[model samples]
Target: MAYDSIEDLLNNGGLKPGDVVSQRELMEKTGATLGAVREAIPRLEAEGLLITLPKRGLMVPSLDITFVRDAYQMRTMIEMTSVPFAIKHISKSVIAGWIDWHNSAIDHLDRGDEEVAQRLQRLDWDIHLQMVSAIGNALITNVYRVTSIKTRMVGQSRIRVTPANASRVIGEHLAFLNPLYAGDEVEATKALCQHIDNSLTLALGGTL
Candidate 1:
């Protein structure tokens, strides 16, 4: 049997931290075969998204704030170090696209659409990743992408987009994007540092 889709099980808020769900119960609810359910549980466990008890079976994992902070810190270092190189290699069109994205994000904020606003927020972050990847370091890009996904998951659990905060975030992103578009390597690096610093500050504050 194939592994059960973990995303499916996470629906409806039924799986709480430390609340175990036996294999039989999982199978009954998901219609997933026993073999599939068994295989998927361990994967989730290894990812720190789930845990298993000796007799009670598997449950969602508890949030670890320390791990979240450490993850953000690690990502900040990796992405920041990539910036100077990215500024050197990134294209004019690419930088312009980033500016466009930030401008569009601002529009979303003005409209007060929280879901779209949140999505635009993530895309704004991706602008930095795209810049990094353009440095043509496959190994660095791959490693950072893995950590990025983890950070995003942790962020989703903790952050919600409000109109006020979204507007502020859009402003912050433009501050970073403008320097990069002008090919101002020194200022671009500074902007990236500030952007990462603000994010680290928020993550440490448990505001994600």
Candidate 2:
């Protein structure tokens, strides 16, 4: 229940920066028990996603320059760390599966499906999270999970949703994947770095 509440915020964008929420409100919203919500608070606090107010209790963290920079820096570090492990350990089958999945998603988007938004959301997580997880390092995977909490928050709050933005995201991911698919280390390094550079720029208020 505790974890679900945080995921709700991540997946649904239920709360905004500066929004104040109480445990009781969370209970009403997510059907989580008071005890579960209580247990969850500390973890959220530890992630710096929320802060305690002396009189107001908990407040969602407002977006800030430092947080944006720190978030992207962490993302870059995670991507760099994962790349070698991913290159060394990611199986051919996994790479092919990812290509099929993403291409299928593009097809569905072209078909004007009602679930395109949710499907795209799933793809975003599948790609980003799976990229790190594929490295097969528990410590790296765990660290990435913590970083993901902030990235999701900032991304949902900042990234513009439009046809152009969508195309850019697809292009960048494919650029990164193509080299990896072909087992080209030098090209993969360039693509991976380019992806992070563009991503950091987008997170820094640049248009896609």
Candidate 3:
């Protein structure tokens, strides 16, 4: 709960990268007990989500170029490693379902449904998370979870999704999903790499 509250602050722009706040302030803002907030701090710091300054307060990570690049690079490495396992083990039905969800999400976004847009973002992460989990390694999955959070933070700080770009994003998802559904290992891997590269560019404030 405490960790989620802090993530909510970051995602909602209540807290930003490089912002510092005292322990009491965090407790108040998150509505968590001081002890709970304190307990959550070390985990967050370990994940590179935030850090403690000598006497200043807890500071969120600054979104510098190197930071963004490293986060996405780590993401690419972990995800690319998962691709073989995902392609081999993930069901065709599941891939089809994902393709359907992306298509539906695009339609909802076209209608200006903010709720669906938010859900679509979650689904985007879920798809990647599912791929990583397909490897069946708890340790790597845990590491990927932390990387995902950092990547999402970078993306939220930099990318603003408009209808035009949202459709484009879904299209990118389809680019890989269709090949995966067809059991084309080579094509799937290539398309997934391209999609991740596109995402990295967007996270770094580049256009598609």
Q: Which is the winner by TM-score between candidate 1 and candidate 3?
A: 3
Model 1 C-alpha lDDT per residue in residues 1-208, reported as the tens digit of each score? 3343454344224454446778878777777788787877766666565667777777665545686777777777777777777777777787788678767767767777778665765576567678768778888786666455455455553343466677767777778778877877778777777777776666556443
> Best TM-score goes to which candidate?
3
Q: Which consecutive 10 residues in model 2 have the weakest lDDT in total?
A: 157-166
Clashing pairs in 2: none
- lDDT for 157 in candidate 3 is 49
> Ranking by lDDT, best first?
3, 2, 1
Candidate 1 vs candidate 2, TM-score winner: 2
Clashing pairs in 3: none
Off by over 4 Å in 1: 1-60, 135-139, 152-158, 206-208
Pick the winner on lDDT between candidates 2 and 3: 3
Per-residue alpha-carbon lDDT of model 2 for 1-208, expressed as tens digits?
6666666675557876678988788667778888888888887888677788877778888767687788778877777667666777787788777667666667555655546546555666666777788778778777777666666567674563343355556666778777787877677768878877876677677864
Best by lDDT: 3
